[model samples]
Target: MNPTAAILIIGDEILSGRTRDSNMHFLAQELARVGIDLCEARIVPDRMQAIVRAVRELSAAHDHLFTSGGIGPTHDDITADAVAEALGRPLSVREDARAILQAHYDRSGIPLNEARLRMARIPEGAELIENPVSAAPGFSVGNVHVMAGVPRIFEAMVASLLPRLTGGTPLLSQSLRILRGEGEIAGPLAALAADYPDLSFGSYPFQQDGAYGAHVVIRGADGARVGEAMTRLAALFPEDRAG
Candidate 1:
């Protein structure tokens, strides 16, 4: 099986739907490129107990657990502390992380205030994930990885961390969208999926120009199987096939 992974989005803002989640989609695409299958994702509020539960559950379920949000300088940012509780470890300031934070303070001429110092505290024994965009570093404790919540910064951190992970055979996907409704092709796509159990077939309906249609996406770890499934899918809608 491909190296399975999951994303844990830790924030009340996300669950409240005030913030649309882009990190999961970003991490999903990036991990897939590195051959890690993103199996599941969970979003939790900024509560300590909730965050702890999510971390423990998702970490146990997947080979890797990526958590975004709540690792900031504010009081509401408590992902690091909650993660420590989940792992039954102490949350302490690390010398390595302190050095980075201190240097950031020095360079910016900003005082190392208590609010800013909160960023230095990490779960014991966790390795730091560099934040090139910002000085605040992320950390990896066991299978659980914690990073910042801000979008641009979070994306940068994920790009840096993904390369260090070992991945499985990358899944390949191919897609086709026809000007026909999903109902028109559901039976054929289902047959293709059944014939190639290793391949994942999906049909998505869309509305365009006052017409309804479907987009068919086929996925499989094996390129040959994915191609065969696509060919069979296309054969079902001959007139819709483009040159």
Candidate 2:
């Protein structure tokens, strides 16, 4: 079985509609590519209690937990502190992380003010995840990896982090679009799904130009099995084509 992972998105902007979150979508795809099943995701405001509660629960529930946002320079960036509290670790500025931040700021002629120094407060005994986009650096505490919320920075951190974890076989999928509603094909789809217990069958409905249809997707870790299931599914619905 593939290792399962969860995401905790922390920021008031996401909850307040000031920001549209793309990190979760981006991380989901990246995790899938590495064969880690992204089983759950949660978004919470920039509150200490909320961040701490989610960090503890999600880290315990899945093989891996990734948090985005709340690790920046501002006062509201409390993820590092929350995660440390949740894990019962001391939260403080480490020299390594401070050096990274200081170097980046020095190069750009930016002063290392107290606000900027907040980014260096990492939890105890955590491994740092590289941030190529910015030098603040995300950290991995046990199973949980805390990263930046900005899409580009988050993606860079993911690229740096994925190499550290092992994954199972990537799921393969084939799709077919049928000119029929889900209700019309429910019975056949159910039967097909039953025929391939190891594979996953999904029917997503869509209406285009006033015509209703559904796209059926078959997925499995075994490519040959997924292909066989797709062939049978298409044969079951002879008029179907690729969507």
Best by the lDDT measure: 2
For model 2, how does the per-residue alpha-carbon lDDT over 1-243 read when each residue is reduced to its tens digit?
A: 999999999989998999999999999999889899999999999999999999999999999999999888888889999999999999999999999999999999999999999999998999999998889999999999999998899999999999999998787888889988789889989988998999999999999999888989888999999988888888887865645
lDDT of 1 by residue, 1-243 (tens): 878898999888887888898998989889989899998988889999899888899999889999999998999999999999999889988888888989988998998888988999988889899999878999999999899889898998998888888988888899998778777777777777889887788778888779878888898888988888888788889887432
Go through the candidates in order and give the C-alpha RMSD of each one to the true structure.
Answer: 1.3, 1.0
Q: CA lDDT of 131 in candidate 1?
A: 96
What is candidate 2's CA lDDT for residue 231? 85
Candidate 1 structure lDDT? 0.88
Give lDDT: candidate 2, residue 224. Answer: 91
Pairs that collide in candidate 1 are none
Error of 2 at 142 (Å): 0.4
Q: Estimate each model's TM-score.
A: 0.96, 0.98
